[model samples]
Target chain A: MIEFDNVSLRLSAFALHEVSLTIMAGDYYFIMGPSGAGKTILLEALAGLHIPDEGRILLKGEDITGIPPEMRKIGLVYQDYSLFPHMTVEKNIGFGLRMQGLHHPERKKRVDTLMKKLGVGHLAQRAPLTLSGGEMQRVAIARALAIEPEILLLDEPLSALDPIMRDFFVDELRELHREQGLTIVQVTHERHEALNLGTRMALIRDGRLEQEGAIDDVFVRPRTRTAAEFMGFENIIPGIVSDAGGPDCRFDTGTVSFSCSTKAIKGENGAVCIRADDISVREKTDPGTDRDNTYRGKIVAVNPSGPMVRIDVDIGLNIVMVMSRKTFESRHLKKGSEIVLTVSPDDIYIISTGTPDTTCS
Target chain B: MTSRIKPDLCLISFALVGSTLVILILLALLNITATQLSDIPFLLQVAQDSRVTDSILLTFTAGLNAVIILVLLGTPLAYVLARTHSRFNNIIESIIDIPLVLPHTVAGIMIYLLFMQRGLIGAPLKDVGFIFEDAYPGIVAAMLFVALPFYVDTAREGFEKVPLHLENVARTLGATRFRAFSLVVFPLSIRHILNGCILAWGRAISEFAAVIMIAYYPMVISTLIYYRFTTGGIKESTAIAFLMILASFSVFVLLRLVTRYVGRYDDRV
Candidate 1:
């Protein structure tokens, strides 16, 4: 396990403010944040590149805070691959082994094994500059893995590739993790990539850890407005709990009321985060749904984005819902169309409660 | 057709004006070669002359030694300057470039004051039997002083062209800072380093005012050519000048060919 105990760092215009996180052994942890959010700084800190000014970094319960990167036994791969242009593919892959003083025969064997495993054996003699983007990425990964690091740190690894290549490498990385049982820490801004690959994840904003937990908990139940916004929670309704005695509560937004499940007391001020895909939309004439958290609204906008369509409905309050293009086309939805929207009580997560003045608005 | 031909004519005129200096240099070299070739026996006699051969050899050896010292000392400074960004580094960069703008005579005077016998550095060294007065050390000092900026600036440019992340990756791969630089940064910047050495050696060998100010004896080719011109008229000096030119040209051509071969993988980086 790796643990970051309230780490704080200041680098020129950017600063990480007492951020803390943990990654267990064999866990694929993804760090997600917006651009300039200090995600890469946190990853580099874990890799021993940046020494923290305020806290200790523990590796497997041992304090390794002041250790240098070379002795940390952690490998870092950048998005650009950063393969040495002076070396050929084989040499680049074997660079780590050579650095560790491995003998010729053993080094060559390890390099050959990694090259064949990563499917770049045929390009061993070719220089990095001559390789394709995918080829260079594999070579970089192989080079990192040749060290047999306890944890591999990747900085936006798939962001540099095209969609097709990204999917291919995502599977490659998954298999590598499973076959080798290697702990991986990836930093990216893409939410889907994190959801697809991460067992645990953390969301950072403005150099602070907004939320971190198991993948299902962080994604399905974001703990703050910023975390919810980043996790694609399109409908964040701030309200005061009007009736809260049991697992179910009536949340009043002054304009619209929602029955959501929460553990807060009555008169608590908080917000309910609901994913766009969780809210179901239907024509007003099509009935058979219960009226627990249902509302009548008019479609305000329809945006078709490749395979998905985003619809904005104004039900006294604006709520966004995403559906498949086929579903949208079959429903014949358009602007100014009357529609019924239903959201399950379990799908709504309450957050930012207890502090009345600091409630999200 | 007329409109297209007008631009072509304008371009040709521009090319002709721009190539005037090149044309003049070629014309001068050809004129000297043609004149010297007509008197084959006299040219052969000049080539066999001990003074001409010694001066040429001295010039090359001193210039080469100065260049080697510059590479050893200037490379670290160049790499640091390339990778660092600060107000102090900017000040240091400006100081390194001072030699480039100084007049050769002024530079010669500066070298004379610093390394002359009983001078600041020369006085201490003189106590140890290392004299800089009309000696080989003085010749090399003058050459090194004038040629430092050429090597530092060119090598710095080369180091700047290499991305920093490559070295960072190497460090993570279990290499220390020095190992990372030697394995990754040095090989990538070799082409620029060689080019810098060539430029610095050329500058060192061509330096005349400075070498003469400190060491007129053990004459370099430049000093010998100047001396020959002062005592023996244009005809006598021309022979030594022709031989020096032939030797310098041959070395430069060979160095350029080697540089081309070494820099074949330059564009890939």
Candidate 2:
């Protein structure tokens, strides 16, 4: 188990601040953020590459905050494998064991088994420069693991590979994770990779950790407005409270009204989020006329991305709702066409927008 | 751009530059006298001379010794300069190139003043039974002073380019800082060190003035060549010059092969 308590790291242009995290034994955790959000810094802090200024880091209940990186039993795999180009794959993989002065035959036997398992057994005789990127990455991992580290850390391991090769490499990593049950702390900018690999994810934003939970829990429901937006919730419709005294309050957007779930915590200026799949688009503006959450919107644009198309509908309030391509195609919605959008009260997720829409705006 | 030279101008410049370089080579090759060319076979009589063999051995040993000392001490210093960002690092780096620019004769005078028997360091050393004025130490020092820029500059470049991330990965692989440098940094920079050795050896062999000051008694091949040219005449000097060319040529071939082997790993770019 690795635990970070109130860790804060200040570097050149960025900081990883007050980040407290727990990596349970055998858990696969991912740290994800946008560029400059200090994902890499967080990984470095955990690996003992950078010591946190304000906090303590404990590995297996022992404070390892001051320990040198070499003494820490943590494996790190980077995008560039950092293989010793002068040494053969066998020699590179055997380096750690050799440092420990493991007998020649014993070290060779261990290296051979690892080599076969990684399926690079035949290439052991070759120089690292002669190997492919994927092969080099495997050798790097093998070399790190030859010491049998207590935990493993990867920093954008697949970012260096091209699209086609990335899939195969990701699969290889998954197989290794399953077989070893090694505690992992992987940092990446790619969301899909985090979702696929992480049993749970810690979301780092700006300098601080925003939130962390099981993958499905965070995906379906996020605590903060920023978290929801980052997780790909595009429907942000504006509305306010009207019947505030009642058990359920109705908020009016002037153009449209919503039976808001955000009524309990009252605010004049706020943003509401409804997931793309949650909002249903209808051809005729007939059903649910008297309902609270109904708006007539013009389908501004339709973007087709693989199996799903997201429709941007203008609801006259400078707000847009995104819906699936299948739903848009079935309904036959086109640009410059009129459509009606409806949302359930439970689905009307509204919170204060602290930061501007830098991505969308 | 107007600065772009026209094809006709470029052709003329290229031809002019080629002619100038070829003429310089031609001049050096043509400097020997007709009598010297005729007496070359008679120099074979001098080739069997003990002085000739002793001079070659001394020159080769000193050059090799200078290179060995440079590698032993200079590589680690280069690595530190490569990795450190302190103000002193830049100052030290700029100072490293001073020997290449300073007149070798001036360096020789400086060494003579500092290390002669009555001079500052040599006075105490003489009490300890150490000799510096006309010995192998002085010869090796002279060669080292002139030959070091090649080693430091090349090795520093090698260390600078080996991305710091590689060393970090080595550390994470459970190797200590010392182990990382030994297992990762040293091996990766071997080619650059090879480049340094070749340049240093080439510089050392071609050195004249500094060697002329420090150890005139125990003659190196360069001093021997100078002696023969002034005393025994041009015939003997050209023959020794020819032998130096042959010796340097084979090492040059070896360097080319090694560079090609390294170039395969990292593309020329």
Candidate 3:
């Protein structure tokens, strides 16, 4: 396991503020954040590029914070692929082996194995400058893996590729992780990439790590208002908790109350975080008995969101719901249409309970 | 009619002004060659003359040696300047460019004060039997002093073009700082370094006032041409001048070709 104990570093105009995280062995860990969020800085810190000003970095329980990158047994790949333009594909792949003092024959064998594995063996004699983007990316990855690092740090590895190439590399990365059993830390801002590949992930904002946990927990249940927004929680309704004696509780929003299952206690001031995809909309009909957390509302707006359609509904409070284009078209929904919105009790996540300024709205 | 003619007039004037230097140089070279082509035997004799050939060879050799030293020592400084951003580095960059802006005579005088016998650096070297008074060392010192900025500035630009992440990746791949530089950064910047060396060498060879100030004997082409012009009149100096122009142009063209060939891979990406 790798651990960062309250690491703080100050770069020009940006700083990572007492950020700490633990990445376990064999975990595909992703560091996700917005641009200039210090995600790359944390990855670089793990790669030993930047030394923390006030903390310790431990690798397998050893304090390797002060060690140089060459001795860290870690590999880093950048978004641009940073292949050695002076060397051919084969030579680029063999560079790390040569640095590690491997004999020529053994190095050649290992390079050939990695090249074939990464599907760039045919371009071995060609210079990196002559290779395609995908080809160069594979060569760079092969070069890093030739050293057989214990941990590989990738800085937006797929952000440079086109959509199709990104899909291809996503699968390639998944297979590489499974085959090598290498602990990988990837930095990205794309939520789907993180959800698809990461077993565990961290969310960062303004240089501070807001939350970190298993992918499902962090995505489904964020712990802060900022984390909820970043994790795509579109509905954050401030309210007070009541009826907290059982597995479910009532969230009284002063205007309306929502039945939610949460760990929050009675009289706690918090907000119910709900993903846009969780709230479903249907045509309003006669009042039904299954109206636990359902409400009749009017569609205030209909906005197309790529393959999904976002409908803003006003049920005494503004709430956004997203559904697939097919489902939206089947419902024939539009602005001013009357609809009923229902959210499961399990989908409502209580966040920032009892925090100051979290007044009921 | 005026609107249509305005752009045409601007284009013609711009083209004329831009081509003026090329036109003047071509005319001068043609005039010199035309005057000398009729006297092939005399031209051949000038080429065969020991004084002319030896002076030309010495100039080329000294310029080449100066460039070699600059490449060896200036490369690291150039790399450092390229990778670092600070007030101190800015000061160092301005100092490196001092030779570029200084008058050639002032540069010569500076070199003379620093490296002349009984001077600051020359005094200690003189005690160790390394004299710089009217010697080969003095000629090279003057050349190096004047050509320092050409090599360093060009090499620094080349180093700057290479992304720093390449070296970082190399370090993570188990290479030390030096290895990363030597294997990754140096090879990528070789074309720039070579171009810088060529430019410095050209500047060194063409130097006149500086070399004359420090070392007038063991004449370089420029100094030899000056001495011949002062003592032997126009006819004698013209032949050497034509030869020197022809030789320098040929070498300059050859080096440019080599640089182009080395940098052919640059545009592939």
Candidate 4:
């Protein structure tokens, strides 16, 4: 287990503000944030690259805040792979073993094992500069795992690859995690990657970790408006609770209303966080009467991406809904078509706006 | 008519600049070859002379030693200058360039003042049984003082080209700071550092004014050529000069070929 206890660092132009996190043994954790949100800094901190100004870091319950990177027993893989340009693939993979004073024969055996495991044994003699992007990535992973680190920190590892390669590597990484039960901490801005690989995740914004929980929990129930927004909740309708003296309250936006189940009092102005995937779309008259909240809206945009299609609907206010491609094709979604979106009251997450959106003013 | 005149002017400008460079280099080559032709037996006599041969070998030895010392001491300073972004680093970097712009004779005078007996550095060194006056140490010190800026500036450029994240990643991969530098940073910047060493060594070999002040007794090749010119006629001096040119050219070509072979991993790496 790795624990960061209120780690704060004041770097130039950016500061990590009181980031506390814990990664359990065998956990596949991801730190998700936008560009320049200090996600890389957090990963570097775990790798012992940046010492925190205030706080203690514990590795397996032992305080290791002052340990140098070489003694940290944590491996790091960067987005560019950062392979030793001077060394061939075999030498690059064997570098850590040499540093550890391993004998030549043993080092060679271990290097060969990792190379074969990562499927780069054939390119052992090839220089790192001659390898393709995917090949270099494999060698980098092989080099990192050669050390047999307690935890591996990956900073945007798949961000450089094409979509097909990204999926292939992501699957490979998932398989590795399951087979080895290695504690891995990967930082990424790509939401799909986080959703796919993350067993637990932390959402970071403006250098502050806004939320941390199980991956499904953070996606389904983001605690703050900012967390909800960062999690790609498209229907962040700012509204106030009315008729709130019950299990379900009517949250009314200036332009539309949503029935949400929350303890927020009457006249409490807040936002309803709704994931696009939770809001299901159907033909105008095809919906059964079971949905607690249903609204008829006109489709304003149809965006089909891979397996899912995101359709924006204007129901007094615009709300985006995501469905599988098959559903989209069967319903024949198009702009200007009328559709009914059914969103259950339980799916509508209500939270304070955290900070007002003052940029427009 | 204006467009036609513009093309004509552009063509004339290109031809003028290109021919000037080509002609100047050819003129020097023609002059050296003509001098050699004037004294074919004299060239062989100069090459065989014990004093001339000793001076030529000594010059190369001292210049090679000076370049080695500069790499040992100046490389870290160059790296610091490349990575630092402070006013103090700017001041230090500017100080490093002083040798590049100072007059060679004036630089020699300054070095002489600092290394002479009873001088600040010389007194301490003399006590340690290492005197510089009239010795090979003095020769190398003078050469190093004059040639270091070339090595440092080129090395700084090389260090700047390497991304800092590469070193950071190496550190996380179980290597300490020095190990990472030796395994990653040094190899990536080897080509530039080698180029710098060659430039510095070449400058040290050709240096005469600075070396003449501190250590004229040991008689480096450049100082010997000067002495021959003052005592003997132009024919004698020209023969030695041609020999020195041939020696320096051969060494330079050999070094360049080695550099190209070893530093083959350029942009691809």
Candidate 5:
């Protein structure tokens, strides 16, 4: 278990603002944000490589904020592996044991067991430089695990590889976690990567964790506008709740009206949040099946995106609908075509109107 | 990654000039012995004297001492320099390289003056019973002064090449600053350190002016050769010169083999 209790750290151009998180035993947590968002800083802090400016860190419920990284019993893996070039694969795996004053024969035995587990037994005698990317990663993991650390921290471990290798390495990393049941804290900016690898994900923005939840919950339901936008929603427009319909609210988007699902929707002017994929396109004559939140508009633009088409409609107010290539081609939609934009009342959630005031949360 | 190459005449001329200079140095060194070539065997036998053996041994000892001291003292300095972000780092690095380009005789005089008992470094050093004049210490000091650049430069290069990421990774892996340097930085630099030692030893063995000014009693091979040439005629001098060549050549080959064995992992080929 690793916990950051109100930890604040300052680095060259980034600072973590009073970050407090608890990572339970056997949890695979990924903290994600854009570049310079302090993801690396937080990981380094957990490892005890950089002391936080404020607050204490705890491991297994014991305060370890002042402990050195090695003594903290936390293992760290870098993107490039940082394998000891002078040592053979087995030696690299056994380095921590050697450091701990373990006997050579005993170290070798443990290393061999780990090599078999990682399917790298044949590579024991080879130098690390001779190994492939996947092979090296396994070696690094084995090296870290030799000491049986309480927690394992990976800093963008797959960021150095090509796209294809990334999937393979991620799978291998997942397997490693499953086999060891080690507390793993991975930091990455790639949303898809975090979504795939993390049992629970923390979305960080501007040095603060904006939201954190299980992958499914965080993906389908984000708590804030920033969280939704970070999850790949590109179209966000401003609007105001004109009427409180008790169960559902009517938002006046100036040019276009939208019905949102805000339970406490009273006296609020905010942005109406609709994921581009939530908007559907159909011909006007036969209105699409009973979805209450629908608008008629002319297709203002149909732009080609990789494997998806992003179509913009001007229902007097411009709104976007993103669809897969098949749906896009099937609808025979063009920029000049006239279509109805339909969204479920559930799909259009209300995002707090202006910049969220300091006390909004 | 690259564009087509364009050859220039100036570079070709530069390389030609370099090769010719090496050839000229070799020819000049060998020229004095041509006339007395027939009497070489007798001269060669005379060259294997106590004087020749002692001089060679002394030179080797001093060079070894200087190199070992440099490694012990210079490593931490190099690492500190590597970590610094200060603008002063450039000035210090450039200053370290001054010995590399400075004239040998001029360096010898500088080292002499610095260690003259009444002079800056010498007065303090003398308090520790390290009398530099006409002693083995003087010879070693001269060698160290001339060869300082090789170790410092190579060591700095080694420190720089052990990428910052590797150190960070070590730190994250639970290693402390000192532990990280010992395991990661030190191992990575061993090969470079060996190379520096070889270069330093080469410079030390070939040094003449500095040793002459500081220590004349414990005569190194170069000084012995000069002393022999002035006292005895060219025949006697050629014998000592040729013997020194053979002895230095064999020692160099041995050092090369050892360095290769130790650094086989670092060898790309």
Candidate 6:
């Protein structure tokens, strides 16, 4: 486990602002933000590479703020892999062990096991420059893991790989977490990687922690409009809380009235959040479906993504919804076609007024 | 395509000018060596002379020793200059380049005053039974005086080319600062360091005025050649000069081959 307690660092032209985070044991934690959002700075602060200007860092319940990176028992890998080019793959993997004063036989055994696990054993004798990007990344991972540190910090680990390679690496990382039970805190700007492997994620914006919780909670129920937008929630409808109660709450947007799930006080101004995938399109006369919230809108665009079709509907406010391609074909939806949209009250999240609602282009 | 023999006029002109300058130097060296071709036996005999052989050996040994010292002292200095960002670093770097601009005779004079018997360093060093005036130590000191900048500058470039992130990664992998540099940086920048050593050694071996002003008795190859030219006439000096050329050429070739092998992994890092 790692804890960043109000850690602040001031680098020239960039900084980390009182950032605090807690990563649990065996947690595949993700720090998600746009590029230049100081996400990497936080990761480095945790690694003790950059001494914080403000707070303390506790590792395994002990203060490691004063410890140097070499003594911190942390492993970090970069997007470029940053493997030692002068050493062969085997030597590169074995460097940390040799640095730890491990004897030759023991070092060899450990290195061989790691290389075999990472599927880079055949590249042991080859120079790093000769290996592909994935191979080099595997070697770098082996090298970092050879030291057997308490935590592994990755800075955009899969950003340098092709799409296919990135997918493969993501699966490998999931397997690595499952099999080794290593606590990994990786930082990336790609939304899918965070959504895929992160057990817990913290969304950062302009050096501020916007939201932090389980991945499903943060994604389905973002705490702020900015957090919702960052997490790819495209439908944010402005509304005022008319009736706030236990099971269902009534919201009035001056254009339409809907029921959502919330605990806010009555007369509280807020916005309703809905994920694109949570909205379904149907005919206006479908009496068999007993949806709690329904609205009529005109389809503005029909975009196909793989086997799914995404429709942008203007139901007073533009809301994007996705459905299967087969459903789209059977319904015979097209641009300029009028339809009704249905969403469950559980999928509707309310963000109260006075919370920062910033959006980035 | 129409002309079937289109010439790159700008490139042709540049090549012509460059080749002319290079050919002039090559022809001058070949001409000198060919003029003494008939005197090969005479040159061999002069090479067999104790004074001639001793001066050549002394030059090589002193030059190599100077380069070794440069490696020990200049590497850290170069690393600091490359990594540190401040006005003070800039001033110190400019001061290091002073030896390159100052005339060799002026450097020799400065070193002479600094290492003379009554001089500040010389007096203290003499108290410890080591003298620099008219001694082998003075020869090496003079060579080091004018040749240190090449090694430091070249090595500094090498250090700058290595990204600091690599060392940081090494530290995260449980390597101390010194360990990371020795294992990662030193090996990666070795080719450039070797290049610097060759340049520094070459400059030291070819030095004449500096060595003559400080240690004229234990003549280096340069000093011995000048002495022979002045007193023993052109014929004897030419034979010795030709022999020195052969020795220098052989060493340069060997160094080039070593540098070539080392360069194979240069781009990899």
lDDT of 1: 0.89
Each prediction's interface RMSD? Answer: 2.2, 3.3, 1.6, 2.0, 2.6, 2.4
What TM-score against the true chain A does chain A of each candidate get? 0.95, 0.85, 0.93, 0.90, 0.90, 0.92
Model number with the top DockQ: 3
Docking class of 6: medium
| lDDT over C-alpha atoms for residue B82 of model 5 | 85
lDDT per residue as tens, model 1, A155-257: 9999889999999889988998999899999999999888889999999998999999998888888888888889888889888877776667778899998
lDDT of 3 by residue, A1-361 (tens): 9999999999878899988899999999999988999999999999888999999999999999999999997988998999887788998899889999999999999999898988999999997888888988898899889999989999999988999999999999999999999999999999889899999999999999999999989998888888788788889998888557557778888887888877657778889988888888644563534534888899899999899998899899999999999988888778898888888788888885684332232
Candidate lDDT values, in order: 0.89, 0.79, 0.89, 0.87, 0.81, 0.87
- What are the TM-scores, per candidate, against the unseen true structure? 0.91, 0.85, 0.92, 0.90, 0.84, 0.85
lDDT of 5 by residue, A1-361 (tens): 6778888887766788888877878889988877878887888788877888899998878898888877777788887888888888888888888777789989889999999988899999998888888888888888888888868889888887879989988888888789888889998878888777788878888889887778777776677778878876665667766777567777787888777766535557677778898877655575665636777788888899899998888888888888998887888878888877788878777776454222211
lDDT of 2 by residue, A1-361 (tens): 8888999888756787899988898878888877778888888888888888899999889999999998886888877877776678999888878877799999999999999988889998998887888888889889888989878898888888888888888788888888998988888877788778788888899989888878777766676766777777776655544444434555566776678654433434455677777777654635664544767788777778787777777886644556666776777678888877777777776654443232110
For model 5 chain B, give the 10-residue run with minimal summed lDDT: B260-269
**The best candidate in terms of TM-score:** 3
Can you give the lDDT of residue A358 in candidate 1?
Answer: 27
Give per-residue lDDT, candidate 5, residue B108: 86
Q: Model 6: per-residue lDDT, tens digit, A1-361?
A: 7888998888767888888889999999999988888888888888888898889899888999989999987889988888888889999999889888999999999999999999999888998888899998899889989999768999999999999999999999999888888999999988889889999999888888888889888877788888888888878888887776676678788887778866666777788888899888655566634536888899999899999988999888788999999998888778998998888887888888753243211
- What is the Cα-based lDDT of residue A192 in candidate 6? 89
User: Which is better, 4 or 6, measured by DockQ?
Assistant: 4
Supply DockQ values for each candidate. 0.54, 0.43, 0.64, 0.58, 0.39, 0.50
Model 3 regions lying over 4 Å from their true place:
A237-257, A265-270, A283-291, A305-307, A353-361, B1-16, B38-41, B266-269
Model 2 chain A worst lDDT run, 10 consecutive residues: A352-361
Tens-place lDDT per residue, model 4, A1-361, is: 8899999997768899999999999999999988999999999988888899999899989998899899887888999998887788999899889888899999999999999999999999998889989999999999999999878888899988988999999999999899877999999988888899989999999999999999999988888887887888888888877657557777899888888876666777688988887887645566555536888889999888999888889999988888888977787667898877788888888886543332110
